[model samples]
Target: MKRFFLLVLCIFATSCTGGGSCAGKKEVAALPDTFIWNLYSDPKSIDPGLVQENSGSDVGVQLFEGLTEYHPETNEPVPALATSSDVSSDGLLYTFHLRQDAKWSNGDPVTAHDFEYSWKRALDPKTGSYYASYFYIIKGGQEFNEGKNTDGNSVMVKALDDVTLQVTLKHPAHYFPQMIAYPAYRPVHRKTVETFGDKWTHPEHIVSNGPYKLVSWEVQKEMVAEKNPYYWDAQNVRINRIRFLLIEERETALKKHLEGSAHYTDDIPTLKIPTLKSNPHYHDAIQLATYYYSINTKKKPFDDVRVRQALAMSIEREKITNVLQQGYPTRNLVPPGIPGYTTAKGLSFNPEKARQLLSEAGFQDPKTLKVTLSYNTNENHKLIAEMVQNMWKENLGVEAELYNQEWKSHLKNVEEGNYEVGRFTWIGDYVDPLTFLEITTTASTQNYSKWSNPVYDDLVLVQSGKERDPKKRFELLQQAEEMMLEQAPLIPLYHYGRPLLLDPRVKGFYGNLQDMHPVKFAWFEEEK
Candidate 1:
């Protein structure tokens, strides 16, 4: 799953001369053969192994090709680095045949050995990858990541030859192919990483196997990439270059889009939704994502289950969703519409019960239970935090201080357990109930709540993967979600919708559940 707050930036201009066409405004001319996107923020990390958020994955997908890639229209896994693959009858062994034509941007041949090294490096504990658990399905992956296994060779991933990669799984995973399409499974140029160390991802030093290669990155300002001629299918890659403008304000981003500076942008101001609902360029789709408040369970007051439950029960989710004019209000962690799975409901708004629960937890006055609510910088997040802050004060008589930080710093604060309650969002990496459920497991680095239970670990980490029967496996997952909800380590707010603005000239971008638009498949329409 992807972590990080969703938002965008733009500077507002006062006058539009010709109706709504922004006439007389000196429009930023669209560059021929280039696709300019308003990438919400500067990606925290472009390194696939360390990226845990959409900002990073969005750019990473353009620069690195995994064994499989998501289909433009369907999001189904399709061959990329690997031309084809075979699975053993037992479903535990996977053999991927690498594409002989594939080569890194630096002209080095892309081989199966790169995949083997990349997977092992991701699983290395020193790497501190939040997504390392994703490899646990591979045999010996968990042991190696947990430091229980010292030998890297013990992991089941291996390069049988220059073109063949073999992987042995601990159990059958029906979605293994789809899982490999995620950024965490993308291969890195082993030599580049070893030589440059932390600077390997710099624009000049990076060597990639995807359709595009980084040419420049101006930190919070912008990043530019040019098409990679060494890429296996480079001829079919229509866009010659991509400019990702790091815009942080929705109003400013909208203004830029209106001024013809951007071809595609997913950030829209909440207040402007009604006016833009019927605009030809406006697009909205339900995404496989959840926005919630993660409680620091190890911290005081939140350490009590009663306190956590009370906090959850006091949220007026319906009001928040209604105000934002976005998102489907939800109490369940897993969003609906996943095949073969049903969502389990959790705590609902009950001000009286919340007050009683606070009293029962030894905080009778409620006013004495003061806490801080932290969130990343964004207009919507700020508004939501204020709304929740008021709800807690009015319902439970609890006072909360609202703290905001930039996207990168906010993620660090949450990971370091620096807040009593923090705003968090998770966009599914792949379409599956487990993608959402597994993040809360005790050993999960994404578990910012710092809450754990043996039953949850057993159900999600151990039993769910091993259960071969689809129906039985889903039941175990549902049960695990219900158990976690009962403890209230997090308050599920809503399943958000991805609101986007696209120029009519943009083509090949399709709406999908995961909200992923691989730039390799997108192109600008020829001018008539």
Candidate 2:
């Protein structure tokens, strides 16, 4: 029966391709060991320490290996560069045993020292790593990054030997192994970075320790990564090469997939969702991510809690999500289905209360209040921005100017606090509420809104990490999220339902909660 079904599927696929021409058969027979991915946008930076965007990490994962990596099927963190690890009785100290077989793309040995140097570089103040706070779990890491301590030696990550690394955390964290899988913790070739400086990431200079090594990069067009011969698990890597295409338009990406030019694409036009739902290649699943608008709290008018709340309460999130046919409307930043954590309900659409709040915030004549709404250049984002603009105008008589910028520029403007309110999305780095909650803290570089509350910070940054009791820790996190929602520094819009197109020939690709599909395990099935 399964064979019969596959036969039918093949027939259907052929019929859809150029009116069942022999050309389609030839194309299928000639499928290469390369995985062509529509990355959708040009990655801002592929440097492990510097990558904060999803697109960059998608590419970074291909070219780097950390102590751990996400399991292809489960999204669970498993040992990668490290063969195994031992935890001390206190659970504060972790000792990782490096895999001796691990080697960089250039055939250099990957050692514990590489991990130590890469981690320290991330924490170095001069690196300007936006994700520096993620390493705060390590003792003295926060102090070093914040410039409170001048000694890098004080930070408790130490290479005990060429093959063993010792890390002492300020607090006990059971999920430390999982957290290390994040791109920020990946090791870079120390010598290559030192010699080339910022140019170390160029294909000619880069020495990576993952399944793939970047061979060519044409800015704004495509990046190609060939298999790394020296990678520790090279024997298991199926995909020999990966072509990351920078196709910004969703329509173009879908067209490329349909035309057999690309095997995988991260986006499809929202309007096409209804028709594409019937296609076998179409995949739509709720990811552990949230889309929201980051209000620059440091800016005037937005600084007022009432004003921020008014803006948050005014948006009809359901209408936007319904119209788009993607994502579940959400007021809470963290999506549901996390183990042992209950999502906190946030302020819903109440335009009457929003108007009252606006008046209370001293904007009696709402026309006097004008703000700019910024988003990256994408049709979906523009549509959402337009909906939001109209909602603000109609609900509270506030005028919102839509400011669109390309991906890189949008990231820069948000990072530098150059925009009033910016569209943003946060996908969980690990399977934890801390991944989303930590972004609201003052120390977080992801906190584009620049919203800070001491009480909220302590709960998430300090208390939650130290609490060994899962129940108590979750409660602390929930409280923090609730408090953050009341302040409304950012307006939560929806939990992401990522719609992707994957060619039938592609195998070993699973849609995990993180939406992260490591290409090392993916391969094209041989044509029958």
Candidate 3:
């Protein structure tokens, strides 16, 4: 689950020069001796509290660790830094036993104080953490984040001793274990953070407790992670180091792959996909995210649900998925197989319904109804935007302006309220539907659309607290989803399915719902 932007660059000039008996092919760079993986965008920050997208979060997984980790094969929570934990009978308090051998990259012993400090830092209003919603379950978390409390002393997070940690929550959450697997819940060294201040994210300043340590960082070039010799599980880790190359140029990255310059390349261009399918090296993987466009509810015109519904109904989702996405688009907001995801039904393309709704909203002259739709600067995003632009024009008789920006700028615009309609996608941080649906709630910092409804918010809040009866909880969540789809808060576009280039020599590699590229246990084999 990488958050990358689409960057368009001037193609390198290539020519075919033929001698009397042979043709010359384009020359490309040779592969390095190190294991290199190409990324489309550089992370804005490796700090878990500041990261809002998957790409940044995944990289954080290498440099940080929480009390728990998710087993990708089972999608179940397991111990990472914490050795064991127990819950109280009331289910509001949890006590954890830290790993005695755990140590930070700087050789500092890991302790419950580290966890306590990290949690409080995230909840502190001054920290400006966008992912603090995950900690709302802890008692006083909401109050602390809202500035109603002076400091973390009032919060439920506490260090009982050097190895024992205690936590108190507002209610019992069955999915609580799963939530901590994400980086936002990871422990940070208080000393390192305070020492570096604003420059904490730089490679030289960061201290990690995970399986790897930051060896070096060259912005827009490549970042290196070497094996952490002090890691508690260092004996189990095989790879000495992993090289992450920032390859913003898609064609160049592909050319490098052809020249054996990188071990992995993600998101192959649509034009080259067909020819690569028959190649032995080709591998396809499904991404657990849904791509869609959102209209800013705080803004005019979009302030009307009728306009939102009309806009949603106008687009022919089938054509977009079939033609633009090559039949990989998913219409529903929550991807199937996740909890609370029901195959009940969804809104379909109805030009007449869209036009009538638009007319009802007093936009009969489709020529006058114009809105800007924002998209990232990737080749696939451009194609999808062009298709949606055509659909809105033909169906609703409205001219929609296509606005494209770099991926980072596009995300910033959405978060900062610069775009009227923003293109976005969210891979689930966990397997629950709430992970996907709850972000749009009125109070959620991730809710870029400004969609707020008391009824919708109440149901989600209630479900989050209820720990018994999965069926009943899902029923309430289903109702909330129906409400969201009916109002058309955002037009659900399609589910993601990207082809991965899995090396034949590599094994134990699997695609995750979060699009996590887990290289820890993956290894190459020599055939006998």
Candidate with the greatest lDDT versus the true structure = 1
| Per-candidate alpha-carbon RMSD to the true structure | 6.2, 6.3, 8.0
Which stretches of model 2 miss by more than 4 angstroms?
1-30
lDDT tens readout by residue for model 3, 1-528: 221111221212121121121011432132222456777668777887777665577678777778877554444566777777788777777888787999999899989999899999988888888788778879999889988888779999899999999898887766777788788988888898999997887888888888888878888888888778888888866666767777777877776665555656776777777776665456666666888888899888888888888889888777776764343555577878765557335577788998888888888898888899999888888888888888888888889899988888898888888888888887777777787778778878778898899888888776646646677777777778778888887888888776655444444455455666545555544223
**Candidate 1 structure quality by residue, lDDT tens digits, 1-528:** 121111221212122111232222654464558888898788878998998888899899899999888876567777778777888877888888888999999999999999999999999999988799999999999999999998999999999999999999998887898899999899999999999999999987999999999999997789999999999889878889999999888798888887778878886889989987776567788899999999999999899999999999999999999999999999999999998898887988888999999999999999999989999999999999999999999989999999999888998889999899999998887888889888888988889998999999999878998898999999999999999999999999999898787765666776568877787877666334
Residue 165 miss distance in model 1 (angstroms): 0.6
Error of 3 at 214 (Å): 1.0
Please give the lDDT score for candidate 2: 0.86
Output the better candidate (2/3) by TM-score: 2
Query: Between which residue pairs do clashes occur in model 3?
Result: 1-515, 3-55, 6-377, 6-378, 330-494, 330-495
Off by over 4 Å in 1: 1-31, 526-528
Pairs with steric clashes in candidate 2: none
